[model samples]
Target: MAEWLIEEGIGESRAILVEDGAIVEAAIELPGALRPGAVLAARLAAILIPGRRGIARFEDGSEALVEPLRGTLAEGAAIRAEIVREPIPEPGRPKPAKCIVTEAPLRPAPTLRERIGKSSIHPPVGPDRFEEAGWSELLEEAASGEIAFPGGALRMSLTPAMTLFDVDGALPPAELAIAGARACARAIRRFSIGGSIGIDLPTVPSKAARQAAAEAIDALLPQPFERTAVNGFGFLQIVRRRERASIPELVQWDQAGAAARALLRRAERAPGAGPRTISAAPPVISVLGRNPEWLEELGRRIGAQVRLRPDPALAIAAGDVQSAHS
Candidate 1:
């Protein structure tokens, strides 16, 4: 049966839609992020585009990019704003959360459980259901931006503008283009990627081949998305409603944090645990140490003492959990 297997992990909540014993889609929600639909009371911090757009400073000192502002309102004027999109992390200048002026009641961001309401919620526990559903492979793809299909591979690159996928393999141009397009579409859905996307397929001279490649994307990708036809240059663009960071964005933004959270999840499921020792790189250990509450909760859940050990030689993603007896 198809179901969303949710795992409320230490620092993040995750869900995977499993169908026929395979993951079709996945999502991760980090705590404290300003999810869409959250309303905040704030002051106009700065006027970016005179009367049309400005910055809103919340009471907590954080700021969001607010738009459709009243031209009469100057800086320092209090206003209620509703978040339309979460902050997007980029190379140097990250995009701030986006909001619109509103009179809606101020409400905290919805929790993952609340956001995914009434869905077939299967709280996976005791066993690592996510790992069983190729979770590690998904994370690897998100981190490395390399996905392998049968006859070709997709190299995804994240840019300030859009996510680009370059398809390459040892196949005929027409055949590879069709297969790569399908693979790219599946990966987009699997990673919950949104926003602007560009796919570069093999250059096929035949217009019919280009149309077939575009059709492959349409066959797999769901609605609420717009895509341009495959052009003569074998380039296609897709636009999806982006509200929050995708899995690749989250992993690439802070690899150490991603590793830390993943380690915590693994430690929670370690076998025959008494005093569990988590060994990893210093940065990853630092992330875990900063969150003592997460460690305490891990201990409480596993009925053991959680310990952190930093190894300079260890890679961030090479964290290992060992039982006291081991």
Candidate 2:
């Protein structure tokens, strides 16, 4: 039976669904994000489209794009809104968080544990259950946007419009299409990716081959998603409800922060226990420095002092944790 294994790590929380000793789905939740389902008290900042859409400024000064505004709601008028989607980070400008006017009481966003519920298993800190289940490998895939499967590979790219996957390999066209479609479907689920998605499979002239490719996606991906039929160009489009940021979006948005959090996770499990030293790039060190509380919690959990060493030569993702005496 599939089970969710959760790790409440420093600065972030991670969960993976494991079946047959392999991960099928993964999710990571970072702190302080305005997650979906959070109802907030806000004032109408501006009406971008009269009686339809506008920007709402929350109490914290954070703003979200709100829609379906009532005709009577004027600028600076107080109203309640429920977040529908977290802010999407794009190249130049980030798309603001999306919300709809609501009468729901203002409430804090749900934490990962709260969202996942009590049924998920939370493993003790000593053993790295996440690592054993290929957590690092999954992160690499999210960072690089490359996923390999049996016959082919999918190169994922995040764009302002949609997330796209381009399939490539040495397999025959028909076989590659089927395999790629399946792999793309799995990648979408594994990464908790949603919103609009496009997949480019190897072009197979035969209609039967195209049908097989489409069916492969149907077999792997669950419901609550709509997908277009594979066109002659072997392109398929999928649309899923997007709530929070996907793993790729989170990892890529703040590379240094991601590295720092990942290093802290390793530091928590680092053996020997005299003192833990994290040697990382300057930006990663800066991220850790900003979150002194996270470091303090790590020290408390491990019963040892934690230190940071910034090495300019080290890559952000290549940070290492070591015992002082080792």
Candidate 3:
């Protein structure tokens, strides 16, 4: 049976799904997730498709496209809306979100993680109940892009449109394809990589061989995924439903933001704290500097003042949370 272990920290939350003592799927919610069912006030930013589609800006610097059920809307108009889809960050483009205009704030819907936690089938476990489950090591591998399996390896790369997994090793093409397919499925679920995915396997000349490879993948990958058959060039395409950005994207496009949230999580978890301070690179500090609410909440949670110090010499994404007196 699969069990969910949820850890709710200041500014963020993490839910890990463990089955047979191994993590299979993980979901993380960051600050300003803009998750579906969240009601927020938004100002119409622009008329993209004239009346059909328009962009709206939220107070938290997030933007979503608004589609009213009825009535005319114009630029700079204030509207209460419910998030339909969370914003997705695009390379060199604005983060895009979608919403439906509402006259009043509707009751928020349950998030995916929340629903999973409350499921009678997989109830959530206590916080830190599975700290020894090697989650850090697994996440480290997922972020690194290189995953090794029994007979082959997967080189995962993220692109603006889709994620690519290239299989490589000295094993026989058929054997390597089978092992690589299973590994790719595991990586996709473990890292929570969503949206478009492409897997490049070793070329198998025979039609039967290729079919076997595809079957191997089908057996391992779960439902709700649309995939194409392996082509002559050994390229397979799979599309998964995406609501939120994957772990790699969060770490890639928003290193400073991720580090700052991580710092706050660390500071809030510190024990026997008189006062705790986070020291990070200037960019990280600057990112956190924009939000004082997190610090204020930390003080209330820990019953101590919290501070952030910027160090020019520190590397990006490198930060320390320590006693203020240290």
Candidate 4:
């Protein structure tokens, strides 16, 4: 699996999808390489997805798709992406239009926004208990209206060291270990990985050791699946892939934006001291927008009750781009 780092951070942000590489038609940015400091966007409360059927329309209509996602964010964090495009579209289809996308931070967690899934496992699965084996496979499902991918099985994993996945060039891998890794991380994204991952796997691994190492990469990168450095013993430390890019791409960005506003606006109206329950509870709510009043307006626009909080201001910021499952 692979992890990205956003160089700048996003503040009061939202994603803008560009289409045919122009504003007339919008498209959302997908992730490729991310810096360490700007990885927080994936951890934010909501992500907007632009579905296959509505890519151009979503932007042309500016009708954001309201798909719930699993992430949390502050304001002014810039979301950047490094995508590996498929050289060709379907056999009979016209070539895809070149596209450019960007994300702008929103106000502090929007008071009213769509509810993504909640944190399934909190405090995380520790490193010492790696061998206990009581962990259930992460099954994808809906915490609310939004759905989680790779939910059929294989939950996300986490490791202490940063994982550096060497994607041969800038393209998606098609094999199982690589495919599964890309698929998993693109679906569930709960844990953080460290260290540069070097992929030396051949098109086929003749030895068991080589095969296991590949498996370990897939297993150890997602949430709940926690571990440290893969020991040199050659035994792979396989785990679930990091879940991301599902709801983001499944729905239209406009729809997702509206839902996010609705969710946050409700939260902004909340009379309680802490956050409210949305299908499940999120650690924090993201009120991403450029203006505090706009965020407040968003909350007020919603009938629900939650107090809105302001985010610290910053001159330069960046957000994280999500990896896609498809």
- Among the numbered candidates, top lDDT falls to 1
For each candidate in turn, the TM-score is 0.96, 0.96, 0.82, 0.23
Instruction: Write the residue-wise lDDT of candidate 3 on 30-66 in tens digits.
Output: 7564787788877888887766888888887778877
lDDT of model 4 at position 83:
17
On TM-score, who's better, 1 or 3?
1
Tens-place lDDT per residue, model 1, 170-268, is: 999999999999999999999989999999999999999999999999999999899999999999999999998989999988888999999888887
* Candidate 3 collision pairs: none
Clashes of 4: 118
Best-to-worst ranking by TM-score: 2, 1, 3, 4
Following a full C-alpha superposition, what root-mean-square deviation does model 3 have from the true structure? 4.0
lDDT score, residue 274, model 2? 87
- lDDT over C-alpha atoms for residue 172 of model 2: 97
Tens digit per residue, CA lDDT, model 2, 45-77: 999999899999988889999888888999999
- Candidate 3 lDDT trough over 10 residues, lowest sum: 119-128
lDDT of 4 by residue, 1-326 (tens): 11111111012212211223211111112222221112112211123442221121121222111222113423222332211121111224422321122353422221111211221211111331111211111111111222232312222222122222222322222343344444434333322221222222224333444455456555644435643332343222333332222232222222333334334423333343332333211112242433355444443444333333332331111111111111
The 10 consecutive residues of candidate 2 with the worst lDDT sum are 118-127
What's the lDDT for candidate 2?
Answer: 0.89
